[model samples]
Target: AQTVTQSQPEMSVQEAETVTLSCTYDTSENNYYLFWYKQPPSRQMILVIRQEAYKQQNATENRFSVNFQKAAKSFSLKISDSQLGDTAMYFCAFTGRGSTLGRLYFGRGTQLTVWP
Candidate 1:
């Protein structure tokens, strides 16, 4: 089984500010995919960004970016220009092949609040 961990249960940031959410995962597979998903009040899991295990470069999407440290098994999300619309439950997810195929493992999620 793949495991993901989000250390912070809650976080808040002012408008136009920046914030980083920490995440770590444990997996035995060498080839896999890591993702940061944002689920707003609407409860739709939006794919913020993704990183492939074999890639050395981190992934970024517009205002969202990821700090992926393969050796340390760390993948953290950094949100630039925090907006009130960004407030939501952010989840760190993992998917791989073999025994863990066809399943996505998710962290408990960190509730992020963007204050005006």
Candidate 2:
């Protein structure tokens, strides 16, 4: 079975700074997709970033980026210039291509609080 792990359960940051959320996964599937999704206070899950198993370049979106270590199956998210709106519960997810009906496996999540 595949599972995602987020060691840090809670995190905080000051406005206009930076923060990184750590994530790791255990999977035997050779090909898979990893993702970072943010759920704000409203409970809407928004994709922060994603990386294909074969992609070498770390996926980046605006102030968000990921450190993907394929061999170790580690994926961490870095948020630069953090803002109040960036506060949310971040989840690390995985979807293995080996499944006939692809399913999403999510980590427990890390709650981020951005303060002024």
Candidate 3:
């Protein structure tokens, strides 16, 4: 049973600034995938970033990046140059590689609000 945890219930950041959301997970499997999904007011889940357990280097997408610590079972999302559109609920998710595809276990989520 893999479980994701986001300690921060809510976070606010000023526009054009940077914000980092913390996430941790507990998984016994050696190989798995971690993801950060953002759901705006529209309620659509969008992939922010992803990191593979085998990879040591973090993943980066535009202004979004991840701090992946495999040994600690921690994966955090860093949003740089935050924008008003970035305001949403960010969820940390995890899934196993085999037999359980597309079934993601998500955290309670951190509500992020970007102020202008």
Candidate 4:
């Protein structure tokens, strides 16, 4: 079984500032995918960023980026110039070889608050 851990339960950041959320996981699978998802008050799980285990370079989209350490099994998300919309419950997730199942093992999540 794969396990994802988010050490911080909550994090606060000022708008326009940068905030990094930490996540670590334990898995035996050689091939897999890591993801950071944001769930807002609407109860929708939105994809923030994703990192492929086989890729050496980290993944980034706009202001969102990830620090992926394949060897250490650490994948952290960095939000640059945080915005109010960034306030949400962030989850770290993993999917093994059977991605067709679309089954994801997720972390408890970290509640992020972007204060103005």
Q: After superposition, how far is residue 78 of candidate 1 from its true place, in Å?
A: 0.3
Which parts of model 1 have CA positions greater than 4 angstroms off? none
Query: Candidate 2 on 1-116: residue-level lDDT in tens?
Result: 88899999999999999999999999888888999999999999999899998889999999999999998889999999999999999999999888613899999999999999
lDDT on C-alpha atoms for all candidate structures: 0.94, 0.94, 0.94, 0.94
Clashes of 4: 0
Model 4 residue 53 CA deviation in Å: 0.4
TM-score versus the correct structure, for each prediction: 0.97, 0.97, 0.95, 0.95
lDDT of 4 by residue, 2-105 (tens): 78999999999999999999999998888899999999999999998899999999999999999999989999999999999999999999998864247799
39, model 3: CA deviation in Å? 0.1
What tens-digit string does per-residue lDDT give for candidate 3 at 1-116? 66789999999999999999999998778888999999999999999899988999999999999999988889999999999999999999998876546789999999999999
Candidate 3 weakest lDDT stretch, 10 residues: 94-103
